[model samples]
Target: MEAWYMDDSNEDQRLPHKLDPNVPVTLEELQKIGVFHWKLNADIYETDPELQKIRDERGYSYMDIITIHPDKLPSYEEKLKMFFEEHLHLDDEIRYILEGRAYFDVRDKEDRWIRIAMSKGDMITLPAGIYHRFTLDETNYTKAMRLFVGEPVWKAYNRPADDFEIRQKYVNSLAA
Candidate 1:
């Protein structure tokens, strides 16, 4: 996974809008904001030991695959718009990329945007209540496995969700 500060460009969102100075963000720094990452063999992900261990440890009992593309998705444009909106979830947002690539933009403690580029074999878990957004990269396609602790929840509270308890707890976590 590659991460860096997103440039404030008005160009297409699919294009890599890397910052001018190219400041990179490391996995360790991402951890400070409650983001977790792992790289696993996508081809054998169903039986991959590392993935199994993570699921077991995290109590992820539900899983499903989603293909995001103009042709594959019913309301591709609508969905992409929603996905790109800064939002927070009541539960952790977990995704394991199996094909194509995308970017996950997360807000740092100072509210700066850090774009995380993810591709096949990459798995990322954005802890509950982190204001973030996702979008397909230049390829405009991605197949990902979504995991959940139990029943899957698709609700996303658009930003300015600071009133929520989950958001409060997340802010407190960063203070720690």
Candidate 2:
């Protein structure tokens, strides 16, 4: 996985949350931000016993595949546009990369964009209401498994809106 500050001109400078160059991120550092990452040994599937156990424990009731590539994206062009735009959901956004790569640009407490590049076997769960967006890496391809606790809804609440006050406050609390 690759991560760096969005504004940084030098791609070689890898930083977590762009907090400091001297201070490498520790396990605590990652946990503090409410972003959970995990490595999977087997392919994730709704019917897989392990995945099902996780779904049951996490209250996830829905699973779907999102494939993005030149040929497959045309039908989803409109939706993909919105996906690339900064937005948040009322529920946590969880994704497991089944194939290819994608970059999830998430905003830190200070509002700096942290680009999290996910590849095969990488799984991430972004807390609800965090300002974030997604785009395929240079390869322009990604197939991921999306998990939801309820019926999946594609409603992406754009930023600077009042509708997500509760979630916004929760996200702000994590900063402190």
Using lDDT as the measure, the top candidate is 1
lDDT of 1: 0.95
* Highest TM-score model number: 1
- The clash count for each model shown is 0, 0
lDDT of 2 by residue, 76-151 (tens): 5565566768888877888989889888877776777777878888878888777888877667789899999889
Alpha-carbon deviation at 102 in model 1, angstroms: 0.7
Worst 10 residues of 2 by lDDT: 10-19
In the predicted model 1, the residue pairs found to clash are none
Q: Kindly list the per-residue Cα lDDT of model 1 for residues 57-77, writing each as its tens digit.
A: 999999999999999999999
